[model samples]
Target: MSSTPVRPATSRPGAARAAGWVAPLCWVAVLLDGFDLVVVGTVIPTLTQPEEFALTGTGATAVITIGLVGMMVGALTIGTLTDLVGRRKALIGAVAAFSLLTLLCAFAPNALVFGILRFLAGLGLGGCLPTAIAMVNEFTRSGRSGRATTTIMTGYHVGAVATAALAIVVIPSLGWRWMFVIGAAPALVLVPLMLARLPESASYLLAAGRRAEAEDVARRHGLELESPPDRAAARSGGAGAGGAAATVRSLFTDGHARNTLAIGVTSFMGLLLVYGLNNWLPTIMREAGYELGRSLAFLLVLNVGAVVGLLVAGAFADRVGSRLAGMIWFASGAVFLALLSVRLPTAGLYLMCFLTGCFVFSAQVLVYAFTSANNPPHVRATALGWSAGAGRIGAIVGPVITGALVTAGIAFPWGFYVFAVVGALGAVALSVTRAVRPAG
Candidate 1:
C-alpha cells in the first residue's frame, strides 16, 4: 500500500492539469444524487391530482419514505462494498444500477410499483454520495478536502435545482413520467464517462494493497506518493477484518466510537432538514397560498441557495475546521429557519429561503467533509456511509413529518419551527465530536 498526498495545485501546474478530472467527474456523479433528492417532490403535485395519478397524501409520503429506506440500506452497505472492491467500481456500479432502476420508474403502472422502483433506485443512488465524497477527498490537496467535498456537493443541489426547474416545465407540459425519464437520461453519458475517464482513488488503491496501481494513479494525477507509518497495520486498529467489516468494527474501538455516534446524530439532523424541505417546500408554499408556479420556484430558489452555501461552507470549513464550521452552519440554519416562521414579503421570503438553504444543506456536507478529514483512508468511505445511513433515518422522517403537516394544512410555520429545532439539535450533536489523531 502507498500514501498519496496532494500538495497545492498552483505550485505544480502540470499536476493541476493531471489531477483535474477528479473534482469534475466526481461533481457530475454527485449531481445525479441531487436529482434523486428532489425529483419525487417535483412531480408529486401532479401525481396527486385527481385527473392524473391521484395518489393520496399517505401514498405520496410512503413513496418518499420507502425510497429513503432504500438509501439507508444502500449507504450502510455500499461503504463496506467500496472498501472490499474499490471506489471506482463501487461508484460506477452504483450509478449504473440507479440509472436503470430510475428509467424503469417512468414505466410503472401503479403507485405501488412506482414506489417500489424508487426504493430500488435509491439503493444505488444513495451510494453515490459517500463514495464520491470519499474518493474526492483522497485526491484533494492537503487541508483542502473541505473545498473538494463541498465543490462536488454543489452538484447535488444543482441537480435538485435543475430538477425543480424542470418540474416547472416538464411536470406541467410533458407529464410526470418524463421527469423520471429525464433524470435517468444522464446516466447514459455519466456511466461511460466515469468508466473511461475516472481513475480509482489512489488512497483506496494503496489501502487495498495494490501499491503499483496506487502509485500509477498518484503519478498520473500529479499526486505526491508518500507512506504512512506501518503502511498497513498503522491506522484503524490494524485493519481487524481487512475489509469493510473490519473498517466498521474499527470505528467502534480506538476512541472512534464517540465521534462516530455524534456524527451520525448530526448527519441525521442535517439530512432531516435537507430532505424535509426538498420534498415538501413546494407543497408547503402552495398550501401557504402561493400558486403552483411560485411554489416550485421557491424550491429552485432554496437549492440555488444550497449551491451558494456549499461554495461558502467548503472554503470556510477549510479555514476554521469542519467541525466548528458545521456547528456554526447548523446554528445559523436554525436562526434562518426560525425567522422563516414569520410571514414576509415576496422578496424577503425568497431571500430567507435562500439563506435557509445556505446553512441547512451545506451543514450536512460539512459532516461528510469532517468525516473524511478525520478518518483513516481505509475506513473513510465506511465512516461517511455510516453517517449518511443514519441520516437516511432523518431523511425518511423529515418528509413524512412535513407531508403529514401539509396533509393537515398546518405545514407552514409549524414545519419551519420543526426544522429549526432539528438544526439546533444537529449543532449540539456536532459539538460533542472532537477530532482524533490517526492510529499509529
Candidate 2:
C-alpha cells in the first residue's frame, strides 16, 4: 500500500513538482541507454590490444554493425509495441533486458560470443531510447515538448561522459571487461526505481479507454491528458490498429508520407554522422598521431559539448522551431567536422572537437524533437520509432563504413569528409520537410 496523496494541480508549483519527479525518472532511463550505447566505443581501444579481444578493424566494425542491426529491428518493432502496450512497460522491459544481457557480455569467450551478446543487448538498447524520448515529450507541457525532449536527452551525454571518465581510470588497470561490468550497474539501480515510481503515459491510457486510471495519473502528475482533436481519425487509420503493419501503413497514407520520408532520410544522415564519429573518433585520432589517452579524452570533450548543445538547441528550437534550429545546427556540425580534416595544434583540435560535439550530437536529437512536435499523440511513438529505426540503418552503415576505412588505413581525412557530407545532407532533408505536415 502507498501513502502519498495525489496533489491537486491547482498551481503551477504543483505541476512543476510533478514534472520534476517524472522528468528525472525519464532522464535516468535514457542515461543508462546512453551509457550502454557508448560503452563499446569506450572499450574499442582496449579491445584491440593483443592481450584483449584482438579484433581486427573489420571484426570490430562487424560487432558494432551487428549490434546496430539488432537495434534497428528493435527500434522499428518495439517502438510500435510501446504504442500498443504502455510506455511504462516497454521502458522497464527494455532497461532490464539490456542490463542483464550486458552483464553477460563480461564473460563472452571470443569475438563471436561478444558480438552476439552485443547484438542481443542492442535490441533492448534500441527499444528504450525512442520510448524514453516519447515519454518525456508526452508528459511535459505542450509548447515545451522540444525542450523537455532535449533536456531529458542530456542524460544520454551524461551517461556517455560517465562511461568515458570511468574508462580513463578503469580500463588501464581493470581491463576492458570491467567497462561492461560498470555498464550493467545501472540496471540494478534504475529498474526498481522505474517500476515503483514511474507513471504510465496518460495519453496511452486514455486512448485505450482506461479513463479512470488516466485521470488519476494526470491528477497525480499534474499533466493534462493529450487527447488530440483528431482522435477519431487517428484511432481508425493510425495507431489504433492492432497490427504494426496497419500502423506503419498509416505513416505513408496520410499527408505524413512526405514528412515521413523526409524525417527518415534526415535521421539516416544525422545518425550516420553521430554514430560514425562517436564510434571511430578516438581510433581515428589515435591513428592520426594522438596518444591513446588524449584520444579518449577527446571523446569526453565531445560529449561535454553535446550536453551544452542540447540545452542551447532545445531553447532555440522552442523559440524558432525545430526545423530551423536543426538546419542551423547541422550546418554548423558540418563545418566543424570538415575542419577536423586539417591537423591543428592540441588546443585547436580540442576546441574543434568540442564545437563539433555541440552541433553534431544534438542535430539528430532536434530531428527527434521535430518528429515529436509534428505528430499527434496517437502516432507519435510509431513515428519516432520509424524515424529512429531509419537512423539505425545509418548506425549500421556508419560503423561499417568507418571500420572499412580504418582497415584500409584511409580513415583519417576521408572519414571527416564523409561525416561532413552526411551532416549537410541532414540539413537538406530537414529543409524539405518544412513544407509537409501530418494529415489529420
Best-performing candidate as measured by TM-score: 1
TM-score against truth, every candidate: 0.91, 0.89
Q: Every model's Cα RMSD, please?
A: 2.8, 4.6
lDDT of 1 by residue, 285-307 (tens): 66666564436566678888988
User: Residue 137 in candidate 1 has what lDDT?
Assistant: 84
Please state the error at residue 170 of candidate 1 in Å. 2.8
Residues 1-440 of candidate 2 have per-residue lDDT tens digits of 00111222446676557556667887887887678667787777677888878989778777767888888888888888887777889899998998899999999988899999998988988888788888887766656766888898899889888877888788889888888888888778789988887888776665544558877787777765433333443353234446567667767875778889999999999888888887788778877886644455677789889999999999999998889999999999999999998988889889999999999999999999999877755566788889999999998788778888888998888989988999999999999985334331
The ten-residue window of minimal lDDT in model 1 covers 231-240
Residue pairs of candidate 2 with colliding backbone atoms: none
Candidate 2 regions exceeding 4 Å error are 1-16, 45-54, 226-241, 286-294, 407-410, 435-440
Clashes of 1: 0
Clashes of each: 0, 0
